[model samples]
Target: MEEMECGIEKKAAAMAAAEEVGRKEEAAAGDVGLKELSRKLNDFAKARDWEQYHSPRNLLLAMIAEVGELSELFMWKGEVRKGLADWDEAEKEHLGEELADVLLYLVRLSDICGVDLGDAATRKIVKNAAKYPAPSKEGA
Candidate 1:
């Protein structure tokens, strides 16, 4: 009985660790601001002497390629809303990898161009909000 209890405890601990990993992966993409992400990407590229290959044009092309790859995952699949969970594990993993590639290239490009992506995104959001205000009850 004691051995069985120990086995169950081990299983519970393993399950908890798995859950934590899943949560971390779920929150991996959007949590970091562009400034921090760009700094990390810049350091990574510098460490590898990859800065030479990271000109804005090259980075932009790489980013566009990744975006195309990501889009291909949903190609001909009509109306992708709320159906991501229906995808197989390999499909989902590929999607995430392509997304990461796009983001890394974009950050590298922004760093090379000295663009403050976070501030630019914030300003664009404000501009968009002013251009498309919420509909009031009177409009309804």
Candidate 2:
């Protein structure tokens, strides 16, 4: 029991340290963009030699799993408001973590697939705007 407690402590310490490093990096970069996140994830995988398991399919599946976890948080909540005004701090933090997981996996997958996610998203937004243009005041 003592050994398990020590192991858990060590794991917690390691995670905290990693978070500190991420915070420092984000501070240094001035703004945390997808490219920075992708680079950080790449370095993280390389450090653990886990890149072998980060194939596109594996990343996609993992991302889907994270999405499922995120969905579970709102499963029976029945259309939460945009601000989540009723949620407590802990619940919001938990939601943030799950959302981060989904985003990190997606960024990593895009990196592996040689996709410029920001550029793609911008182009997609333009395409969507063209497809569904806002009604003019004259029409309304």
Candidate 3:
């Protein structure tokens, strides 16, 4: 079953990669939402038959690893802004790749767990706004 799943995932990923070439046009035109990206990633995995390895735990670990790589880019840099500003094109590209990896794993994990990330994010934002309200005119 595991082998079968891996095969499926590989096929899915290949198909997704091919489709990604075409998707570049859409991506260039406008931003894609988390749900859209999630669907694309799920389709990618389904095609390759790799869902057997997309358990939440594994995905979480993969996300953590990607974060670690992203963090490494900032190591020795005093501040995030300075680090980003100082990076050349290659470094920035590397940073972007790591970030993309983290997002991909996160989206995959959320999809498998049946979480609606957009709704969850909206609720969190509303909760945060209530938790930290703007200062009143009198206070200011």
Q: Rank by TM-score, highest first.
A: 2, 3, 1
Better of 1 and 2 by TM-score: 2
Residue-level lDDT tens digits of model 3 in 1-140: 99999999999999999899878855663577898889889899899998899899999998999999989988887767755777799989998789889888888888888999889889999999999998789965
lDDT of 1: 0.86
List model 1 lDDT by residue over 1-140, tens digit each.
Answer: 99999999999999999999989966885677787788778788889999889877888998999899988988998887685867888988888888888888887888799888888888999999999997889966
Q: lDDT of model 2 at residue 6?
A: 100
Worst 10 residues of 3 by lDDT: 24-33
lDDT scores in order:
0.86, 0.95, 0.87
Strongest candidate by TM-score:
2
lDDT of candidate model 3 versus the reference: 0.87
Query: TM per model?
Result: 0.72, 0.80, 0.77
User: Could you give me the TM-score of model 3 versus the true structure?
Assistant: 0.77
